[model samples]
Target chain A: MTRVVVDREVCMSAGVCEMEAPAVFELDADGVLQVGEPTDLAAVEGAVRACPTGALQLVD
Target chain B: MSTPTLDAIDLSERTFWGAPPEQRHAVFDLLRRESPFAFFAEPQVPYIPVGPGYHAVTRYADVEAISSQPALFASGSGAVSIADMPPDLNEFYGSLISMDDPRHGKIRRIVAKAFTPRVLENLVGNVQAVADDVVARARRTAEAGDGTIDVVADLAAPIPLRVICDMMGIPEADRAMVLQQSTVILSGGDPELVEDEEYMVTAFLKAGELLAGLMERLAAERLERPADDLTTALVTTEVDGERLSHQEIASFFILLLVAGNETTRNAISQGVLALSEHPAERDRWAADPGLTRTAVEEVVRWTSPITWMRRTATRDVELSGQHFPAGSKFLLFYAAANRDPAVFADPHRFDLSRDPNPHVGFGSRGPHFCLGAHLARREIGVAFRAFADHLPDLEVCGEPARLQSSFVNGLKRLPARLTGVR
Candidate 1:
């Protein structure tokens, strides 16, 4: 299983990750990002790669 | 096809930029294939003295590598201009894009708070309303005239301009002045936009002062009575016990005015031109509205509205198999990188359903990646959805009058016909 990890320090909250994988990554009203366990590895990988700030990473 | 000699290509010349789009692409293709780290002299602008040349980083891998490492490739020296700008000009024009962290990071964090998904979600209705009004006005113009309209002016330019104005809470009376000032600031030495090249520096300074002045007044007003607008949020919001000063707010507002207003306008204008050129892709998008997401990404990739950004080497480094000393200047050509065959399949083709499209239309993965990328994407998607809904058969009537500048791949005028309307 691939676990999604977000480096909050690096995430600028551009919301690209949320757009790519809504179920795995979500930005709250205050713009704080919430990371959930990944159900779809492909979508989660896309979100990880699409993050502009290199904020998201996957840990096995 | 025969390969052209390095001497045959002169990207520094204005004539090179004014050349046909295909010709420019061919030059970049050759450069990407043969010499991805080619160096060229800086273009001689009117007031700015010609300085050191820049290595044109054309390949996708090179651009991504350089951008990902901000410490190695610094932006504080200057990011927007090849020549080092004067101190005052840098302060006025630089803003967040021209700084290194922790300054860039601090300001970005505070400003990023204003651009949260929740905040942007609130603006969706405003964006849709502006797009609808723009399309409706274009329909009226096409109906009243010869079924033709200037897409740049009628359809493309107004949506982002008005949306930014509404977001910043600028008065209706001041929006036109804001637009005019921003056009002059980002005109990129285009003769039509910045007439009288002798006074180009004066024109830029005057425009900057006017916009800054306008924002300063608004910031003061927001301070007295906080409102729900971006300016108010910017003035009041504090991060790590640091709040943006009035001057910082003014500079940021100017950055937003130019970055938010001009780049998205070009994207929409160029998107219309692209759709007109590729009717099949247009039909594909029109048939499936779900394609708006990828379609917007394709438009940004294909158009590459802001062609390139300059980054200076902070220290000696090796990049893409090339050695460079400290203080080396490199121009990351997002336009060329987007079309790199190594990264993209059939790089020239406009494929709307392009998934896994990691195009750096908004710079590569880095701290300096465009802060407004999400907003720009939303604006482009909304604008095209309006087109698909109202003018399904819209197409460009003639060749577009291109903006004569290497910095911005823009259209001064795109003659488009609303065929479905009449």
Candidate 2:
């Protein structure tokens, strides 16, 4: 099973994760980044690389 | 028994718009023969009025002194030729190029960790491939019928534009518009392009908005699915327990897009011009392909696209032989300094083999010595080698058109004709 972690403190709500891998991450109503389910390891990995803040990591 | 009256050089009028090739070299020639270090009068901004006196430094030694000591001559003043800004744009100065220590240092560390030299070294083959492809296309276009190619459009434009896009993982479809927006945004001092203020303003805003949207989308995507791309690395890097904000990422993207494309493109276009003018030097490089690296450095000195950057003295300081009170303005001229006879032998000659060439084409030494220098050198050097090898008989078909911007002296259009089709 693939898992993901979004550092709440480091997440600047850049929304890049959501754009790159919507299934793995999304910004909350308050614009805070939140992790989602059905995480595709490759897609989530891509998002992890795309985040300018380095706030996301894949913990599979 | 008499002291020479110190006269400040008026590069403002000379370089107000882009200096023509002859005029550009003439100014540097004069600096080499006459005074290498002098003050430059403040360039007038047509509608905006703000007085900021600048002591221009032309000698390499003097420019080096100012650049190495950013504490003395800071880069936080927007790092532009014009000292004043329209209040609205003041708040948006967090980009790497415009920041001083601590903040600049912190941010640069994170970005550097992501785009390491090893990573850039890996991109060398890709850079060369892109240059080869672009040159091939230019040759094909020239052979098809027109028998003429605008070097800026055909040769100089694509290499950096595509390389940066690829590095950022930006889709190829978006490359052209991204390149166009970068050109529109950074052409700040060029009156010819900005003639229609309304058009320029609209384009600038639209470009910023487009970049912001791209950043947002990319940031969200990267957060979800980490990829092997610079944008992804930037969005994901952490420093001092603080993450970069969305605005920061957007600003970084915009800055890199403009800087990566503009500097490298100008280098390529200007490198071609340098080689064409110095046939012997060009022949030397062609004869021994190993000289590509040094040739790039020499071209950076020869072109030195960014002529001057303004700095303000925080505390009272003495530069060269003059003493200035606190808040004194200084303009460090990189182009003129590159030609100073003291630092470079046969400074006027564009020697491909010129070494120990500690040219400040990027910027003076210190905290802000061009974060993108490595990438630029790779792109420019590889591109020059490819052109020289493939288009062996390449020559400018007509008088190259100058980009009507003093800030970024590049060819707007370089009409060229090649002997044999690639």
Candidate 3:
């Protein structure tokens, strides 16, 4: 299984990850990023790559 | 390897920027091939004192590397201008783009609350509506007068301006004023816009003051009334018991107006020019609207608006086989990097469906990567979709009057002839 992890310190809340994989990544009202279990590994991977700040990582 | 003679290349000359696009690209190609990490004296603009020269980071890989390491290559000194901005101007001009981490991240998080995917998803409907209205108005103007329309003034410029103004709850009466001030702010020292080079600094300061004043007034009003718009959200929203002050909000507002408004406007303007130049791609997009996604990226890649951003070395560093001491400046040339043959095959060619198109048009993958990238992409997509659906026969009738500044890839006027407006 591939897991998604977010480095809150690094994330700038650009919302690129949320836009790419909304199901897996969300930005709450306060702009804090919330990570969910990755159901679609491909989309999760894409979101990790699309992250502007290199804040998201995928671990297998 | 022989030492590259840079006699033929002079990035500091303003005339070099105003030259034809192909000529400029040829010079960049020569630099990239021979001197990927080249240095040049700064352009001598009026009022700003010149300092140490900057390295021209022309390679795609180097731009990406430098962008990713904000600690190593900091932007706090200044990111927009080759010359260091005066301390007074930093109050208004020093927004997140010119900031490094921690401070940059904190403010960005607050601002990002207003640009969440949910927030932007709601904005899509508004953007489409604005695009349609702008296109319809352009058609009416063309029909009432000659078939020709200045795409920059009449069509491309209005859509983003209206969208950004509406999002901020700017009064209808003040929309034109906002557009004018933003134009001057990002005019890139265009002779047509600034007129007298001697007062160029005055022009910039005046534009910044006008925009900042307008935003401060609106922010005060939002504080009292609490309207349902970005202005209200920005004034009210907080993170970790931290809220943006009026000064910070005003500066960010000015940033949005100049960065969000001017960049998207240029992208739309250049999109029309690119499509008109490549009729086959235009027809293909017309036939398959699905290609709007890829076509939007292609336009950004081809145009590379907001040409270069300046980054300074925080510590002594060696990159791409070159050593630079601390405080050395590097101008990451996005225009050159986007067309880098090593990264982009036949980069000069405009291919709409080019996938994995990791063009650094949006400042690459970094902390300071454009905050408005999603909005810009949506605006361009909608504008082109409008063109394909309504003005399929539109084509460039004459040459585009390109912006004189090297910073922003902008068009002052794009003469376009429209027909078959349905």
* Best-fitting candidate, scored by lDDT: 1
> lDDT, candidate 2, residue A13?
53
- First chain TM-score for all predictions: 0.93, 0.84, 0.92
What is the DockQ score of candidate 2, to 2 decimals? 0.02
lDDT of 2 by residue, B133-251 (tens): 99889888999966778888898889999999889989877788788878877776355656665465465667778877887888889889999888887788766887887667888
What TM-score would every model get versus the actual structure? 0.96, 0.81, 0.96
Task: Please state the Cα-based DockQ of model 1 relative to the true two-chain complex.
Answer: 0.61
Clashing pairs in model 1, backbone N/Cα/C closer than 3 A: none
lDDT of 3 by residue, B85-153 (tens): 885576567688888777887788788877787778889999999989988888898888887788998
Question: Residue B364 deviation, candidate 3, in Å?
Answer: 1.4
User: What overall lDDT goes with each candidate model?
Assistant: 0.87, 0.73, 0.86
For candidate 2, the per-residue lDDT at B126 reads 92
Query: Which candidate model has the greater DockQ, 2 or 3?
Result: 3
TM-score of 1: 0.96
Tens digit of per-residue lDDT, candidate 2, span A1-60: 667777754554545466467766655544455677844777787777655556677765
Docking class of 2: incorrect
Report residue B358 deviation for candidate 1 (angstroms).
Answer: 0.7
Backbone clash total for model 3 is: 0
The structural similarity of chain B in model 2 to the true chain B, as TM-score, is: 0.91
Ranking by DockQ: 3, 1, 2
Superposing all C-alpha atoms, what RMSD in Å does each candidate have to the true structure? 1.7, 11.4, 2.4
Error of 3 at B371 (Å): 0.3
**Scoring each candidate complex against the real one, what DockQ results?**
0.61, 0.02, 0.85
